[model samples]
Target: MRSFVTFASAFLVGLISFTNCTKRTSSTATQTGGGMAAEQQLAGDDLTKARANYTNFCGGCHGRSLETFVNRKWQHGDSPEALFKGIKHGYPDQGMPSYDTTFTDQEIRHLVSYIREGIVAQKGKTETKSNAAVLKSEKLNFQLDTVLTGINVPWAMAFLPNGDMLVTERSGTLYRFTKAKQLQKIEGVPEVLAQGQGGLLDVKLHPDFSKNNIIFLSYSAVKRDGGQTLSTTAIMRAKLEGNSLTNQKQIFEAQPYARTRHHYGSRIEFGRDGYLYFSMGDRGGTKVNPQNLSVHAGKTHRIKEDGSIPADNPFVNRQDAMPSIYTFGNRNAQGMALNPTTGDIWLHEHGPKGGDEVNIVKKGANYGWADVTHGIDYNGSKISDLNQKDGITDPIKIWVPSIAPSGMAFVTGDRYSGWKGSLLVGSLSFKFLSRLELDGNKVVREERLLQDIGRVRDVRLSPDGYVYIAVENPGIIYRLVPVSN
Candidate 1:
């Protein structure tokens, strides 16, 4: 639910069978000690023929039902000769693929003897499944007012045309909330890297901002080399005056620098044609860096409020793309808006163990992550049942056991009159606040509104028509008020 950090060190246990088999051929059958005592005396039907040869050639994308490598921590190496040398020399630039001639090395040593004796004893154990499509329940007429409290892991917010409220705190501090709600913290904010899921993310506010007092952040910067450190997802351009943050500058960053903390798909919309769409996150990079076209990590760029690059974008003249790409095989897109009545442009990503999409933001599109996925492979195995292939792009809405979505908006003015254009979204793992209800771009119906109300990280809409929301454990900022019908 928007907090999975974990860099893998343990948690990978058993049960990886999804049916479908029969391939096993290529054989030179060499396995003396390297097979680790024949994977420790392979019992019962040779461990079900090494879990059916790893659910027939490595379950889809590495998942069959062992629930994706438990705690997961693979750059390659879990044992059995480091997963038989990462599946016989694969990782084809992180999209995997390399049976080094399709199995046979004794079927990749029985798929490394079923991942070291039935997937590391299936560590903590997990496999229940069935959330009925990620708990939607339904019910809405909304009302919830807290408006500012503590404030810490906030993440994103932007309203200051004078209504005050700037927030952003994945751990790099920066507050301001006041239309009397009072909360001030702002003090320059730059040096971020608040570790794991990197800090100080998103803040926006300058599409003209009452005459450019500009603003727009998105953090997690850091860079070193020698002993190696590197991080990405930058973008600053401050000058909010009053509660701090002046002159800043830095426009955009995010490239080949990453150590994997978690995707950083920042969000910072603008487009009515003034251009300035953001979003990065692919930070775990490689799967050929989201169908590579010159990385920017999974991508969803587009600039020119200052960061330039707008000569009709779309891979500008394509001398090898990356002219602020406008769409790609996105993976960790943490919500993005801009449809206050069909101005189009909407997105919502993050799937790995249960899809969770929402798409609808074309232009040079691709939208398939790790090459087509309906979601799997965190160790439950399989990552491709192909969620409608043939060129990618297809989401409208999806969300299996993952309601981990974050931040988003759309539902303009009229102080909530039957929830205007709806959209809302924000649910760091079921904290709740969905809404949806569109027709033109297709989403149909989906209620859910404010259930536990704690992890719902971001969901703005206040110029006056009210609808804030930004919750994180202790951090607050509510305001949704609109009771009756």
Candidate 2:
């Protein structure tokens, strides 16, 4: 939606000449061999130009890959003539401006061909019709081995020192998948307010879990205030016994609980420096909480392993600020990971309509959520006038049109050939796993793997060096086993 001004400027450039050309009726451009001829005419430089044109003009709303329009119900027809007329005549009432005088008919034809080609490519990339058991990517061939099935809304997962797995469902049930492939429900999970986006969320183990037997769970903790139920992101630390959780203690809770059930960011991770790092969403208090550090929402926090605040936290010296705050102005960060190579914490947060972001957590940094954003509101309104400003840390990567990123992990070791040091991010909206090849902190290339796999809830590199993915909507867990080509 940040591209609205760009689109408006492009439209206004040819607005004065719009009345010069007569509008074409459907019969004027009949479906015939002419369409095919025009499409075939586009190749090489012309095709490249069309792709650039689309990225400039249409990628803001329609997405760069053009996957936003794929499989969705087209209000108007999607035929070549329909697209041609729609582009030339415009649908002003529907927010689609006509580009009648802006582009020549031949250029419009080239655009049509480019769009149709993108549709075909996206379809082919998503649909897996041949050999469902095995999946192939650009660099590696892999197959999915089903790990667990029939779990509902598996939100987060943790691997134990003994090779057992712990998975938390949004419905507040925790299950343990043993090494023998047996599933058993763990007891003593705290009650959660499983409403909207609030529920049981991330699970993490202590760095010395083998000796401490300590694990942490982040969830929406509910409390009644003034006869109304309110919830906030809370972390519970407990000892994991054979099949139960004991010595349960509430370690940290975001202050000023809200009535809104969504945006309880609850991703938990431990840094290499013997400290626990976690995230908190704005809790629908976008305007107030993110910029105001006195409250806990919309922040990355650091604490000692036993829930005590570290003396060296960024805001520890500020009398008015929360002592545990690491970074502030995050919207709703559901994905947090520790970069194995750099020892830096990486986080990804959801944007409103567009402008999903990936940022490296820095001490006392402001990410500029409500104050500055590349995104617009869900109802097509601008959130901020500026996308960047002084003192606000810009994201390392920004995904326009939003991927709804969740569960991030850095691939370490050479378990998968040619994929070492890649960052795997889950796409909840596109239902895919994104493999980002990084050059230091920058994402140089992105490859989409497991396209249309499911609503990917979590992705993690296990202790054994295999990449595991958790997906919802007929929830299932899968291990990505590399296969030799």
Candidate 3:
């Protein structure tokens, strides 16, 4: 049996292998392919090992359900032989290290079969689910009404006063879905470094958007320092003026931009206090940023509408702290919403292999990330020995096997019976919507909604009190209209 440490190290190396698989006219292609038929021969224990190998090695980058490759264009050939060669020889130039040294030829063949199986399974699941016009939930029967389509990677959405909708796509575009159901591109959007996991992200309308045509966008901003490209989570405040953004101002930017492209935890929400609160991931600086209050990374920050640091912030008077920081020790927090009943800012962040968490944002509180995590590293290494400490604030809810929670919203009105006060959270990994029934701050019951709904990216309540879900990979926004009882 392969040691866990060895497998984890291989997993780390395999992380970048799937980024680019463009056909290379190289001498490596001349290598003889493995017996592709052997892939189907694996059964029982061999099959189990293949699943473990892929999860421990490939799932982090490729996604758990193999949904990453669902609608993706395979730059390289999708043939079994092509997959075998790619895995065995690897594409080092394209950031994928060859796996020939790590796994036996037979093991690699089994891995290829596992991937192919997942792809086929996912395609079948998607086709069957996508064609279903109506979906049933525990409380109400509703149908998916496609409002807008063809936008790739719809990350976040906000509703305007007059029933218009604003959506931000991760590929650096802001779109306005008018009440007339026309999709119009908003101009004057900022330039974003649309790299891996970094791009135009969350968008939110100002609380007083009716009185003031203001909107906020959270994105990954790029900067060149010392001839090295660096990116960080940033916020842009702008006035929406007739399908155009004007008076655009960069209200905030996370400091010490990182080289790594992923983990730009940019989620924006306005609290009842009218303060702009947004999340910033550790920028892959897991060891340095989350525990360090002096840096903005791995923190939830609070600022005034114009982006000024608030005097009442918990760390405002501290010399060694970033004044805007409201909480610390948070991993990549992607889902944030204000609790309608308690008015508390609730957030959920992605843990490593497991331990996705839902935390209530507290002033100057530490929601321990690397220091006290229930999750282990992607490579099966322990992130922290302690899951809880005295000063660390424990999560309100924790998902052992990470669902990869994304967008979140609290059902406010009676529009959806038996679900008014429930918390609706989108699952990116499982491709479902989770509705959590809350007894005050405690989650009493949990139910899965819109199962296999194409990677639910964002869920928001429309101005007229309807649940709207945004899904990626064919990127369509659907309104969940309840049926009469």
Error of model 2, residue 209, in angstroms? 0.8
lDDT of 3 by residue, 332-382 (tens): 888899997789999888876667888899988988877888766543444
lDDT of 2: 0.76
User: For all candidates, what are the clash counts?
Assistant: 20, 1, 0
lDDT of 3: 0.76
For candidate 2, give the lDDT of residue 471: 77
lDDT (CA) per prediction: 0.68, 0.76, 0.76
- Minimum summed lDDT over a 10-residue window in model 3 is located at 1-10
- Candidate 1, residue 325: lDDT: 89
Q: For residues 116-139, write the lDDT of model 1, one tens digit per residue.
A: 655568665432222222322333
Candidates 1 and 3 compared: the better one by lDDT is: 3
Off by over 4 Å in 3: 1-52, 55-65, 70-109, 112-134
Q: lDDT by residue for model 2 over 1-485, one digit each (tens)? A: 01111111111111100012333432323555333234554689998988866654565345456654555445567777777767777654233555554565666788888888888877634322233477888888888888888776799999998899999998799999999999899999999987556778999988888998999999989999899888889999999998899999998988988877667887999988889999888876767889998999888999987789999999999999999999998888888999988999999887765678889999999999889887765323447889899989999888765677888999988878789999999876666899999999999989999877766789999998999989765578888988888
